[model samples]
Each structure stands twice: as structure tokens, then as C-alpha cells.
Target: MTKDSVAAVLERLSRLYPKNIDLSLDRMFELLKKLGNPQDDLPPVIHIAGTNGKGSTLAFIRAFLEKSGKSAHVYTSPHLVKFNERIVIGGKQISDKQLLDCLLQVEDANDGAPLTFFEATTAAAFLAFSAYPADFVLLETGMGGRLDATNVVKKTVLTLIASLSMDHEDFLGHTLAQIAAEKAAIFKKGAVALSQKQLPEAQKVLETYANDRGVTLKSEGKDWKIFISKEGFYFNDTLFPHPALKGVHQYANAALAIAAVKELNSKWLANVTDSQIAAGLIDVVWPGRMQPLKDFPLPEGWELWADGGHNPGAAKALADFLPEWNDKPLHIVCGMLTTKDSENFLKQLAPFADSIHTVPVLNALHPGRSPADLAKIAESSGFRNIKIEDNISHALADLTAGRYAPGRILICGSLYLLGDFFSSNKGVKNDRQ
Candidate 1:
């Protein structure tokens, strides 16, 4: 957890670019070119972009492919614990030695010029991925898709866009169409593009983008689908267990992973049987989303959970799923970045909580929204019994000290907050269904 070579490099890169995001591919392209364009040398890639569910979708895809006896290299952003968490080689995270070498190479390649942390590290991931031998690679965009660091891959075998919603509005345009268009730009003309059922506004833009390129996107409820039945999860008519990840919202994401696997027809996955697909849905491991916190110190008889749901779309998903908790009194300890639409996000989660405590994300470079500021928004959003706490420990202490009754605790709002939480709590990984 301490600052290692990889962390040191990341720390320097943070100073090179503003802590705030500057979304574009220009810096990424330049850095990758200096690094010999390792992106092109990577194995057949399945690139994914979206406002939410990008990580979970990748997890399901990785599980399905691995279950089918395939090895894949995965690249995703905002690592919860370590920088090594971002790059996986043949199912294992890159070793510290390899990660440090990659970072050194990427840093030297930049030649002291400015580059954002994500862009520079993306180059390092591609470099490591290209050097490693693997059957496939799963690449997830860091932010918006079009100019994102991962979008440098011109012709992926499959491109996926998961749930889209209003997020990073300052960088991506404010409207849904604008965000959808940015995500659509990652689509390769010859690739089989698939998406979860999008809202009308977002779907229109996606369909228009597909039509303009003459590519028929296989969409949920149109080309393929999945649902939970009495038997279990059903894709078309096949009965499979529920997705390894929790929450009803994951059914669509699992289906999206299945759809992406379908495009693997040109590769080893083409011959994969339905049974393997069913097993994959039952054996995926995604650490942060709805992850139960155990083996950590907590109040007596109180269960804890953590989610990295930062935007309105993610907030709505948590809101929808909480009602099914079978009457557990939900107490949320929340923190969010300053850039997020706190008012809107709070509006969605406020209705589901019994008591809400606002806490500052102490370690974030961009800093969390002030607890007082967040409290005002929560109060206005009709959140019951709001209080401001200095940090997660303080919030938990308040609950433990009889400020609130024992209940189910949810630590949410930002991935950065969860990153800090996991460093100390180090919760057990979720069990595969």
C-alpha cells in the first residue's frame, strides 16, 4: 500500500497534468508512438466503453473466457488497491518488477514532457500487454470513449458500450446524445457492436451511429436477451445461475458479456458450449461493486457492504436493488468527488437510506465534496437524518456509539472512497455464485 515505484511514477504524472481531467487522445497517441505503438501489437482485443458497468462487464467476460480455457490480458482503470490491479497478464496482475519496468519505460519515453496519469499508465499497460503472450485482451476506457487513452485501438474484434448516463459533464458534453456519441466513436465499423438496452435518448444516438456505419448492432431485447426465471437466469431459454456479481442490474451486464462472447466466434470462444457460458455467469469475481465487507472489524451484528457507484445511473441501480434487501435498515456512509453531480446522485440514493452520513474522501487529489456542502444537498434531496463526519472511521464510530441503531451499512458514492476503504478494511473478495 505504500508508495512504490509504480506509485511514484503515477505521483509525478499527476503533477504533469492538472488533477482535473483533460479528455483527449493527443497526449496518448504521442506517448504510445514513442513507445513503438504497443497497442497495435496487442492480442485480439475486446474494447469496452461506458458510463457504468464497464468493470463488471469485463469481469464477466474474463470469467467466461477463462472458464472456456482461454487466457486473456485485461486493462481497466482506477485500481481500488494497487497500480498492479490495472494490468493483468494471462489472468494474473502484472508483477511489481514488471510493472515498475513498464512505468520506467513509459516515463522515459515521455522524456519529461507533460502527460496525464491515465494516458501514461495506459501506454505502460499496452506495453506490458504486447510483451506478454495471451489469447485475448480486455480493454476498458478510462472516461469518455472517443478521445480516451484506450480508444487508440483502431480495429478491435468486438466493441462494447455498457450502461450510459450523465457523468463527467464538464469533459463530455452535458446532453445524453453527446455522451452517447462519444461512446459510439469507439465503435469499429467492421466489428460486431453490442449494447445493453439503453434509454430512448441514448439508444437513438447509438442506433444512428450504427446506421451511419452500416453495422447492425445486436442490442438487448432486439437481437439477444437474458432474464431471471424461476429456474435461474435465462438467456433466450437456457437456464443459467445468476451472475456472480450481485444486484438485479447485473443481469443486463451479464447478457452484454454473453453478447461479447458471441462475437468471439472467430476465435477460441467460437466453439464454446452453452454449458461453459452458464458456468462463466456463475463464477465471475468483481471486487468493488456490492462487495460484502467481512473479516474486518465492525460493530456487533452489523453487516457492511461497499460500492463504487459514483454517478446517477449507478445511484439508481443501488437504489433499485436496496429495496430487495428484505427490510434491512440501510445506513449509508457516503463520499463523492467534487466533480460529480452530488445533488442528482444524492437524489437517487436518498430515498433508500434510513440514516445518511456524509464523509470526506481524505486521500483524493481532487478532494471530496465538503461534508457540510454534501449535507445540504442530502437534506434538500429529502435524506432522513443527515450528519457530516470527518472520515469513514469517524462515521463508523458515530454509528457504533449509538448515534444510529445497528443496521446494514453501505459505503458508497465514489470509487476513490472505496479505494481508501479497501486499503484498511481489505474486505474479502465476493464469492462466485
Candidate 2:
């Protein structure tokens, strides 16, 4: 099958279910059973769950394994540009023909039962992974971990919980502790559990859960720490050059990846030389997470960065990175779905941004807050310079033409918005392309 054909099949599958995300394991387990229980046949799996940083952590692990000459399968969510980006088999994206064939097989097995798009896609990914051979499989949970479709796997070599925060209030929970407990449900007995630094309440909840399950908890600042310097990050007393990915948060994610590698302690991984680890750390790449668009169709001397940070915790991280820009008069273009905490997100970002441009997300699963509504939220959050735009291009144009000096523009908020930008600017080439 061609790429277009594969996309068509995926679109059909997406329409089969009315809801985009229905976090439950029963339907997924039944579907997997009908598909011949492929999830049980995967390689040593490393499951990652968190409000943010999961995808970047997965990228780091994949790069590390690949640099060591080992094969890995990776599954991530909310593709930036292509649907196929969600599944990586043996260090390469599953080919269009392979994805289409696997989707058809899954559909045949489901017998037309109602299943969310994420559930069906996850089932298809497991089917493809089971068919292929690899040393490790890195899986990122779609939402909260416990009932997430990806949580059905009975056993995993390593499970990582990245920096947890308050997100997905309606589906997961309203408070940090509640949400942390939902994510902590992925901790299987005897699995090596690694966690990033969390809020006090979240940390306590996760610690209690890990203790009860007898999972070895290798935590940041306790079992391992990362020191950032002018040269790069120092992980476990080993210095590495600046990661290939940008942003300070990346150092934390890299540290978590290194911790996971150490916990695996496999002979194949033990054979990895320091040079391999350094090279992999410097080579990792994950899109729409602090991704810079320096070479896009934008004007010269103007910098554009994109991130899919929709929650307050992510907003705080983005704010922390803003000071590094050094009074460049930052312009923020944001679009968010209605389910997100728009007021809190804007409150966290208001102090650092010179101006805010609110736009609507394209093909958003839930009702998208209009640009005007979002601008109002920003204004209520103490931002004076807020404007509503019809779309990202208009927002970019206004930001570039406005009084702000030749500073940087940050396009952020929802991953769905990033996908829309990618679709509209398909012909605009970038260095990564």
C-alpha cells in the first residue's frame, strides 16, 4: 500500500469510534486477544508515563540503544506531521505497506467492535512489534497510565514516570496527588520503576505505590542527578556534551533516560562505550517539543520555536526557558482545546511574554476555545498585550510585523495545533527535513 492508502485506512479507523480518547483497558484487552495477543509477545518493553516529557525520554532511550548498535521499537502519540511517526520498528518508522497491512489485520480481528482510535492504533502497533524483532520496545502512554490502552502489557523490563504535573483534570483527576496515583498504576510488581522529580504530594503518592508493589524506585536527586554546565550535562558523574535537542528540560529527560539504561544493566547495554552514550545523547531528536524553526519560510533574523505544552506545568517550564532569551521581546502564539486549563496556562506564561496571540486548533477532538475566548483568558491572567487571530499563519504574520524587535516567536499549546501548522506549511522546508 502507498502512503496515501495507509493514511486513508487510518482515517477510516479513526471514524469507527465516536470518541477520541476513552481511557479503559477492557476494550483494548479484548481487541488484543482477538488479534492473537501480540502485546504479550513484545521484546523487553520500557513503559513511560507522565503529564509531560514522556516522548522526549522515549527519544533519548531509542537514540541510546541505536547508538549502541541495538534495535528498538518505539511507540509515541499525537504525531506532529505524519501518522506513521507514532510507531518506530527497529529504529525506523514502520513502512506504509506494513502499517496498512497491520491495520487491516487488526480491523479484521476486531469484528467491528467499538474501539477508540488510540486503542486500535495501539493494538496495531503491538501486532507490528510482535511481527518484527528488536532488542527493546519503548512505549509512551497516551494519557493516564492505569487504564490507558498501552497499560495492558503484563510485564516490562523498565517503567519510567517522567515529571508529573496537573493535566487532564476531567479524565484523570483534578489534583496532583490524584493524577499521580492514576499514572502510578503502571508500576507492575518487580519492574524497575524510575521517576523524575515531582511535587511533594505526587512524590509521596508514587513512593507509597512503589513500596506496596515492591518495584525498585530509582528516582531523580536520590539515585541519580544531572548537572548542567556550559559544556553539557553531567549524568552520574559522566559529562556529556549538550544534547542534540534544545531546552533545559531536555537535560532532565536525558538524565531519566540514562537512569533507565543503568537500571536495565543488560550485557548488550553494558558493552556500550562512553562514546556511544555521548553520541546518542547528542543525536536524539523529538519534534514539536522545543523544536526550533530557524530555517522555515519565516523572515531572516526572526526565530520561531514550537512546543506542544498545554498544561500549567509545561507553561512553567516554557516560562523558565524564556529568561534564557534575554529580553528579546517574546511573542507567543497559542491554541488550546477546551478541556485544558487555559486560565492557569496563561497565568503561568503571562509574566514572560510580551504579547499573546490566541488561535483555534485545527481538527481538535473536543470543542476548541475560540481565539477571542483564549485572549480574554490571557487578559484576565494579567496579560495586557493579547490579540486573537484566525489561525497560526496570521498570528505569525502579526507577531513578525508588530513592534516587537527581531526577537523569537513561540508557537505552542496543543499538539493538534502543531499538526495543523505542519499541514498548512507542508511545503515550507526546514533543516530537519
Candidate 3:
């Protein structure tokens, strides 16, 4: 592959727009018009938006649909390892050649237009989905839902909203209601909207938005519920196996996905069985979320884990799961972007972690907080023992120097940091597949 490769094309596309995120659909609409409005030709779209658990919920939905013998075209953002991981067609990651061709075609149609990288690449994804065949298109918003590039789809089969929180307040809004409205904007008329458990303020806003759009809203606690029993978990009356993914929040994520699948079966997957749902629950694979790192350069009896949780909501989830590792003292290796709420994020996890090691996310598109600065934040967040490391390598070496007892080491904070780790460290398997 030469300069026309997908990576090269993506790099060139990044410079097409001056601002990284304009958060407007005008440029995306214009680009789609040039490409014959490929978004209109896609299969039944399942548009998802929220603060946290969007990716995990989508993963569960994909697993359920695929196990039921259905193929879907998936689009998600912030690729951990490669850009190709963001787009999957018919149960397969988009090939480099195919992606390159679509990107080049989009570039040609774009004709050097000033669209954000997300908008341009999303245009390419829609183009590829239009040219391919699939039962559904699982579209995830890159940022806020109202003006997000992926929200160009006029109609959708089901609109799913995961747990909403305050993460991107700068672009979305300052209050929870404001952010909720931005995400609830994805709801289309006649499209039944389903949401996971939400804060009271967010739930009220979502209800108002759903009513204004004449869309039926099915909420987790109100419309349906997941009950945990001595044996296993159940989504309403249907029994489900425990989710393969770690963390207790996965039960709620799985329930939301199972509900979405049930809603889809009436029109699309008519023959999906409860057995299939159980299989999907255990077969799902979502990387960089409480992922266990094995065969890495850690000493014996020492464990390494990685997650992309950068917000307070995600930190709460991590803190909830930390108690499970009570046998091992937890040492945190964290790196975050300058845009995130590092203080609140650290505050949520500081109570659970024994020590905090701050590092910088290498080669991130956005600027990362310096290790020294992050250490200061950790100190302010109630972490007494804080260390500033040059990078993950240095942190790992120091942690394994036999100074402290052998325990678990978690590399978390930003998805970009996890991506850097995956790219730089060799032979460290996280079982993403």
C-alpha cells in the first residue's frame, strides 16, 4: 500500500477542516449530498448515543444480532488500535483496501471541502454501508448526538441511549438536562427509543423530547427491568447468562442490548430465540474496558488491566468493580487528556486504589495532561501516594521493582493512553477478539 492507503487518506482528511470538532451537520449533509446521500440507503439503523457504556451496549447488541444469524454494519468512534476497528461490515472489520477505496471516493466527492475528520470519514462509512448488504447499521455518535456526523440518518429502526452523564460539557452542555436534550435529539418520529437507567434530570428531559417527537420511549426501570437471582440474571421474564465482560454494570448493558434485540425481532430478526440471547451474552467481546493484560512484561503473581474510562461515571463503574480484586492491592497507572475532568475522575477511583502512577498518553491527537500535573491532581483527589512516571514503560518497571507487594496494575484514564499501550507494547494480549 502506498500513500493511497487508508491511514494516509485519513491523515490527509484530518487537515481538511480547521477545527477538530465543529459539531454541526451542515458539512456532513453537504458531503453526503455529493456522495448521493448514502445514509438514506443503509439498512435499518440503530442509532445510539450517551455518555458512558455506548460502546459496550453496542458490542452486546452486535453479539446478540450476530448470534441470531444476522449481519450488521457497525460504526463507532475513537479507535483503540487502528481506524479499521471503527467500521465493521457484515461481521468483519473493514479491510484496508476497501476502506482506502471508500475514503478516496469520499475525498474525491468532498473535493477538498472543509469538513471535520469525523464528518468526512462518516461519509465514507455511509458510502461503504450503502454499497454493501447487512441486516442493520449500528451507528454510534462521535460526540453529542444532535449535531454529530452520524446523526444524518433521517430514520432509524431503534434509537438507544445509554447511561447519560456530564462528560463533554464544553460541547454538549453544562447541566445534565442540557446534555440529555442533545442526546435525545437523535430520537426520530415513529422510532421507538430505549434508554438505560438515567439520572432524574436526564430522564425528565428525555421524556419531554420523546413526547415532542411522538416517539415511544421505553426506559430501563420504568418499561422493563433486569432482575438478578441466585442462579443468574434475567431480563424481564427471559433468563440470561452472565455477561462475559467484567464489571457489574455489564448486566445493565446486556439488558439494554437484549431489549433492543427483542424490539428488532418484530420486523427484522423474527426467529431469534432466548437461547441465542444467552449465547450472545457470553460470546460478546469489547476491548479496553476492564480488559486483562496477559503475557505482558509483568513480574510473576502480578496482574495488569487496562480500561478507557476517563469520566467520573466510568470511574464509578471501575470503583464498583474494584472490590472484586480485594485479594490484590490495586496500583493505578493513569493518563488522561487535557479536555477530561481529571479531578473528578481521579476522585472517584482514589478511594479504591492503593497508589496512583501518573503518565502521559503518547501520540494523542489531543493534548494530554503532563505527568507532574496529573500527579498534583491525584494528590488533590485524596491520593496520598502518587508517583509521576515518564510513560507506561517506566511505570511498569518501577511497579515491578519489588518495592511493593505483588498486586494488580491498572492502566486507565484515557482511551488514547490504552491505544498507545497496545501500539507500543508487544506480546501484551488483552483478548479484544
**Top-lDDT candidate index:** 3
lDDT of 3 by residue, 289-337 (tens): 9998876867788999989989989998998988889998899999999
The lDDT values for all models are 0.84, 0.85, 0.88
TM-score of each: 0.94, 0.94, 0.97
For residues 125-243, what per-residue lDDT tens digits would candidate 2 score against the true structure? 99999999999899999999989989988658888999899888888888899999999999988688999988889999999999998887878988888889898879878898898
TM-score of candidate 3 to 2 decimals:
0.97
- Looking at model 3, residue 101 earns an lDDT score of 91
Model 1 C-alpha lDDT per residue in residues 1-433, reported as the tens digit of each score: 4345767877877778745456667788888888898998988889899999999999998888888888899998787877788889999988988988888888889988878778888888898999988888999999888898889986488889899999988888999999999999888877778999999999999999999997668789988877787667877776788776888889989989887887795444455567888888877888779987876677787888899998899988998898887567788899998988888888887777888999988677577899999999899988978989988988888887876667888999988898887776655453322
Query: Predictions ranked by lDDT, top down?
Result: 3, 2, 1
Which one wins by TM-score: 1 or 3?
A: 3
- Tally clashes: model 2: 0
Q: How far out, in Å, is residue 67 in model 3?
A: 0.9
